[model samples]
Target: MSKWTERMTDLIKSVGGFAKANKPVAEAFHTLETATRADGILDAKTHELIALAVAVTTRCDGCITAHAAAAKKAGASKAEISAALGTAIALNAGAAYVYSARALEAFEEL
Candidate 1:
């Protein structure tokens, strides 16, 4: 009913269609996902929080919705999520700063 819920529902359907059309690639991705999560170094909540932060940085709406729900299910609090997002914000700014230096170098050269 809500905007995010509707988007997630549609995303699920689309992913299903993609899997059906490309079973091998889908299965491979699933395998990779499972293998990564199989490592017990991080708990589910921490993993979901990291995934949500990466999703924000990558600008993936589907990933955001998926990881947001997963983070909630894993008992990540709102403040925890905000902290993860803060890391993402800092990372993006750092990336921009690095790229700005590169742009300046290019301008000097060209």
Candidate 2:
């Protein structure tokens, strides 16, 4: 198998193992999975897009890689993926700017 497929397989196995080993984590996963599967609020495709955005914003390389693949599998086009990544960058930039402003305010007070 290709490296990317191997990595994704490993991630799936790891998460499965974690769920089996930990009750609380398993419950949390179950709840979140259920919510994600729920009708109306967001479809599976949209959820994957949001996940891709979050993975990018948080700089989770493994997650970004996996979720991007998942997004594609869920039928996301290249343009959609690009737009999602752009949104992530914008949000991350805004968050950094806000944090820098807060730090500057604290420095002034000091």
Scored by TM-score, the top model is: 1
- What C-alpha lDDT do the candidate models reach, one value each? 0.97, 0.85
lDDT of 2 by residue, 3-108 (tens): 8788788888887888889979899877986777677687667888999999888878678767878798899999988998899899999999999999999999
Which tens-of-lDDT digit does each residue in 1-110 have in candidate 1?
99999999999999999999999999999999888788789999999999999999999999999999999999999999999999999999999999999999999999
lDDT of 1 at 76: 99
**Candidate 2 runs further than 4 Å off:** none
Clashing pairs in 1: none
* Model 2 C-alpha lDDT versus the unseen true structure: 0.85
> What total of clashing residue pairs does each candidate reach?
0, 0
Q: Which residue segments of model 1 deviate by more than 4 Å?
A: none
lDDT of 2 at 19: 82
As a TM-score, model 2 comes out at: 0.85
